[model samples]
Each structure stands twice: as structure tokens, then as C-alpha cells.
Target: MRGTHPSRRLGAGLLTAGLISLGLLPVPAQAAADTNLALGRAATAGGANGGYPASNVTDGSQQSYWEGPLGSFPQWVQVDLGTQVDL
Candidate 1:
């Protein structure tokens, strides 16, 4: 019976480890908003007419986040209630 060379076996092990590590990588949260809810408009910076309110815009704020192309993709807003709360 033939067996894989020591180097080949090591390479395979490394490859498996790499794949597992990649899979374990943390994934960013993704969000989607309804058209009628004005979520889509806010994603594009087009909701400046106080649709959602200027003070409500979080964008680069520490609480809310907006990602991806200027117009494409959904806006991501992460909210913390200071503590867990049931809605």
C-alpha cells in the first residue's frame, strides 16, 4: 500500500486548517429595509429631506453603520438598547 509523503500530508493538514479558519471568520451583519419604509433611500444618502430625520442619521456614528456602494446594497444599522430589552 502507498501512502502520502510526509510533506504532502503536512500540506493537506495545513490546507484543511486554513479552510476551517476561514469558515470561522466573523461575518459582518447584513440588513435590509423596505422601500415604503424609506430604508432603501437612506442607504443611498438620499434621505436628506428629513425623511428619517437628520438627527436620526447614524451613518458613521458609533451606534449605526452604513456599508457598501454609495447607492447599492442595503443599509446596516446596529442598535444597542444599553441593555437587552424585549420588543
Candidate 2:
């Protein structure tokens, strides 16, 4: 049987270290966890006088967004994640 070249072994080691440092290696417990809690969730704004509904925020489209009425002070938009999050 042939042994792996010294340069090849060093390259493989470096690649493994890089992946571990970047968190690409999966953890056993977290591999199956849901990381994003706000995907496709409902969103609502205080007002949509210009036809920009609050749901636009979660439609996964860059062209659309929730726009508050012009000249309105203290505008606000809210999203419901369906569960409490740490942030």
C-alpha cells in the first residue's frame, strides 16, 4: 500500500482546521436545529395608506416592503415569529 504524500497530509490538515474555525463542521446536537425563527412569518405595520401592506416584509421579495404613510411620525412595523426568541 502507498502512503499519503507529506504535502498532501499537511494540506488536508490545514483544510480541516479552517473548516472547524469557520463553524462549518456540524455539532451533533445543533445539526438538526432550526436556526432562523422568522422565515415566512407574518408581519404587520401600523398603517399602509399607500397600498404597501405589512405582509410584504415576509414575502421574500426584495422589490416589495412595508411602507408607512408619508408625513406620519413615529411609524412602526412588527413581525410575529410565532415563538419567543432570545433576541
Candidate 3:
């Protein structure tokens, strides 16, 4: 009991496909950038008492954790945009 037919169906299908194809564009171009500074400062003498590294220490110790051996860990940690991605 179909009515108007295959021609109408074909036209509708093509239109739908075209619209969907056009929708597949608009991603970030510049990308995103994130980095961890990884800072560490030694604990103030025995103030650390007994706890995590000076960096994670929650006590009120004068000794703080600052950046540690740069080479030992990721130094400048960076994220390049690589290439301008198409959106």
C-alpha cells in the first residue's frame, strides 16, 4: 500500500546524506594545551615529622616542596597544536 514511491524515497535519502556529511565539520583547530609544573620544596627540618613528601605534607612546616631535579622529571611539559585541525 505504498503511495508516491521510490523516486520520493531516493530524493529524501540523498538530501539526508548531504546534510549529514556537512555536519561532520567543526572540531577544535588550535587543539588544547596542558602541562604540569611539578614543583617541590624540601621539608623544613624534622617539621615533616612523618608524612608524605614535603610537597604533599599538610603540616605547617617551614620547609616547602618546590620544583625538583628538572631532568629527573618532565621539565617544560608542553602540548603542541601539531597542525591546524579542520573544524
Candidate 4:
């Protein structure tokens, strides 16, 4: 579980430490939080090729496909998230 629940997290941490101290549980390795900030976010492209729009990338329709403007070198694609997010 995530650490969002403080009371439960504190209890778990205390229990884990106690167990490790008593040699009942081994110390765990560190790991990064697996959070996907881009899920469901909008995408905007500099241009579109025919009917392929940038929105196709995140439209929730896995079958949809996107193609940036043809022959446009180094096109600009941006994610228009409504709020600031930590990468």
C-alpha cells in the first residue's frame, strides 16, 4: 500500500522495525514510487498528418494511432496537463 494513510503507515513501519530488530524480518531494499503522472493526460502536436491527431495518443482507444505532420523535422509535441506535476 502507498504511504497515503499515515496511521497505518506508522504502524507498519514500527512493526517492521520491531521484526527486523528481533531477526524475524530482514531489512528490505529501497525502491522508487511507481506513479504514472501522464496517464489520462492530454497531448498536443505541432501539426497532424491527414486524420492522425495528437489526441489519438491518449484517447484511451488503444487502437487509435497518431502521426505527426509529414516532412516536419523536429515537430513539437506537448502534454497539456492542467496542473504542474513532478516528473
* Highest-scoring model, TM-score: 2
Residues 25-58, model 4: lDDT tens digits: 8655322335545557888888989998887776
Error of 4 at 25 (Å): 27
**Model 1: number of clashes?**
0
Kindly indicate the candidate among 3 and 4 with the higher TM-score.
Answer: 4
The global C-alpha lDDT for each of the candidates, from Candidate 1 onward, is 0.46, 0.79, 0.43, 0.76
Which ranges of candidate 1 are over 4 A from the true structure? Answer: 24-87
lDDT of 3 by residue, 1-87 (tens): 859889999998898778766865443433332432222323332223234343443233446533333335342222233445553
So what's the TM-score on candidate 2?
Answer: 0.52
lDDT of 1 by residue, 1-87 (tens): 998799998998898778767875443333222222323233334233323433354334456443333464453443332444343
lDDT of 2 by residue, 40-73 (tens): 8988787886768888877867798788888897
TM-score of 3: 0.25
Candidate 2 Cα deviation (angstroms), residue 26: 24
- Candidate No. with top lDDT: 2
Candidate 2 total steric clashes: 0
lDDT of 4 at 79: 73
